[model samples]
Target: MDFMIAAAIAALLNIGLLGTIIVIYVQNTRLVQSYFTYGLITVASAFMVQNIVIVIFWFNLYTAGPAIKTIVDAAAPYLFVINLAQTVGLAVMVWINT
Candidate 1:
């Protein structure tokens, strides 16, 4: 698979993980009314937004000129790894929160 494709998949997964985390954190905040939980929800939400932006950027890059595409292609693998790592970390957070 193309590196961009892989990166996109990882980003999608990260988004899902962040969504799950946000849901859980929201529930926790409602129950405990703790500022810390609210902060967690905010951070997870920010991460989710970042992932959404990354996915949109990747989709736009698909139609970019060859020069830009080439540069993005070079960076895609690193991006994928970062996304994948975030996914794992978020998954762990979800697991812990539950």
Candidate 2:
């Protein structure tokens, strides 16, 4: 349960970070009209969608009752780490862009 909460938080953080990247990329794309900027926007958009899905999945698991929770517990730490890593990576990207 704790791990799930952590994972969810990390996922949410990732979504926020990705949103920042996407906005920056969109602004740059508008100013520069470069293919690389367009690609960055596309990739960031895709990552945002992925983080959204991860959050949704966490919510579903939270409401799934005890049976599924045991399974989720086993996987929660991995999910948390994965999401945290993504958040860190995205944060760095945002930092570099800014």
Candidate 3:
């Protein structure tokens, strides 16, 4: 049951992240064109951070039981939000610079 729940949460988070990137990409087309290099750099950095987080979440699930897994799962959302902010901040800086 916990495994199923964790997998579902992971999938949903991935989907949400993808959706967010797409929306940002579309809305910030000007920045993407004028400052695409910087924008790409920011997106790549953000993605690496997010990937590390997802990997850590998986490790926690493997090393800890579902009880702890539950806590990690709860924390994942908050972590995502922080990373999202980081990503947006970078993009915004590039936007402003352009």
Winning candidate number (lDDT): 2
Worst 10 residues of 1 by lDDT: 58-67
Task: Estimate the TM-score for candidate 2.
Answer: 0.94
Cα lDDT tens digits, model 3, 1-98, are 34434543554455455445645665676555657755754774566466556656666675688668667667656655655555556455445544
Tens-place lDDT per residue, model 2, 1-98, is: 58888999998898889899999998898799988999999999999999899889878987899999889899999999998889889999999999
Count residue pairs with overlapping backbones in model 1.
Answer: 0
Per-prediction TM-score: 0.93, 0.94, 0.35
1-98: candidate 1 lDDT, tens digit per residue: 69889989889988888888888888888889988988998898999899999999888887788878888988888998898888889889989988
Per-model C-alpha RMSD: 1.1, 1.1, 7.3
Clashing pairs in 3: none
List residue ranges in candidate 3 displaced over 4 A: 1-64
Number of clashes found in candidate 2: 0
**Candidate whose TM-score is highest:** 2
lDDT of each: 0.88, 0.90, 0.57
Which ten residues in a row are the worst by lDDT in model 3?
1-10
Residue 42 of candidate 2: its Cα lDDT? 92
Model 1 TM-score is: 0.93
Find the 10 residues in a row with the least total lDDT in model 2: 54-63
